[model samples]
Target: MSRTAIVAGQGALPGLVAEALDAPLVYALDGFAPAIPAQTFRLERLVPLLDAMADSDVSRVVFAGAVRRPRLEPEMFDPRTATLVPRFLGAMQSGDDGALRELISIFEEWGFEVAGVDAIRPDLVPGPGVLTGEPSAADRADAARAAEILAVTGPLDIGQGCVVAQGLCLALETLPGTEAMLDFAALHQGLRPDARGAKGVLYKAPKPAQDRRIDLPAIGPDTVAQAARAELAGIAWAAGGVLLLDRKATLAAAEDAGLFLWALE
Candidate 1:
């Protein structure tokens, strides 16, 4: 019987996926410890890890949470991984989406189907509509600007999120991730060049060209709380392109903090 392997990363996502699976094989990276007990492995030992998985009858794989790029040491590479050095280097030059796609191809070549967390729990991906509060006209316009910013920047492999307030672009998610971006927005809420007093909207979506099968955008209760602290009116995300972890608590948090969570149509 083939078993599913959950390649765990850093965050609450892996645990959520595992809870819904039937006897899942959890392989977590060395540095990024998942909240669940998992078999630890390093990317440097890719071949050996695959061999172990094959021996364990693992046929399906799903990746969850954030993974830091490992430092590839040529001396640590096995004979097989050594041959792929050129491709790895090439992936590095092409940006995150390209690199992830290349990695997905590698998993496919090993005869394992790489799926997103949605495979285990589709409910986490909500349909279009607002989960709380109501957005005003200005909020909608800000959201449109944020959407345009993502559309323009997605091809550049910049980020999946941006903040726009009163027709002003406040922040764009960078290497630091969404939370950091929100913190940045919060810090400059009233100090930025513009003196507008209107609240903003935080918009998130998968990179237009990104392969959603691997890394999809995710938000939990913490995200809603952060957005509220940022003094934003609400958050808007692409429907079916983002994951809402712990849906119940997240929605409640949004309600408690008086922030809207809209899944754009």
Candidate 2:
């Protein structure tokens, strides 16, 4: 009777993974999860959770959903967390890819095989195709331009998403995230509601040196809604490199909103 542990975070992805694996869900107390039986731990109280896993049949660990870095207080550090402070601080200072890899290393050091969410749901990675709406020639060019911008920004660990319109770079996502970038794009000079044709395209891809095991770019129903609200031509992402969460619902949203969802090569 093998058991797997899900380090849950925010959004529907964690719930999806839990359902897919029938795994024990664990999460930091600061985040949200479904109203189900799940073990909750504070950011610094990881040892107890690890010990509990060791005592159980759990052999693998998978992380799902998004987690913002928590601020740590020196007074709150337990003995185990105190010892891990250096590594934790290092990961915090590094790029997201490096941080996730460090986390994977930490879990592996505790004798559990770390699994990527893709292991449980391969179909989340859609192949190259236009999933909804129609992209005009200008839209296609914007997608290409956004991709080119991301190619240069990725290696710097800046961000995964960019928006382009009429051959102009509308916005680049930063620490504020993709949705905020879209909001900015929505109000940018080039994206007036009365503008002819489509406004722009949102292009997202993984960082050039990102570890495929975690922190892959993801788009869900909210993404489609935001793209639609941004009055964009479409949302474009690297096929097999982005997680299309709730594929049915996402496509439905895109179709209803008249927003194209393109899985680019």
Best by TM-score: 1
170: Cα error in model 2, Å:
1.1
lDDT of 2 by residue, 108-190 (tens): 98899988888888888899999887888888988988889989999888789998888788899887888999899877745
Per-residue lDDT tens digits of candidate 1, residues 1-265? 9999999998899998998888999998888889999999876678788888889999999999888677777787888777778888899778678888998898888899998888788989999998888988888888988999999999998788999998888889987889999999998888544566568999999999899888898989989988999989899999999999988999899888888899998
TM-score of each: 0.95, 0.93
What Cα-based lDDT does every candidate model obtain? 0.88, 0.82
Worst 10 residues of 1 by lDDT: 189-198
Q: Enumerate residue pairs that collide in model 1.
A: none
Give the TM-score comparing model 2 with the true structure, all chains together: 0.93
Candidate 2: residue 215 Cα off by (Å): 1.4
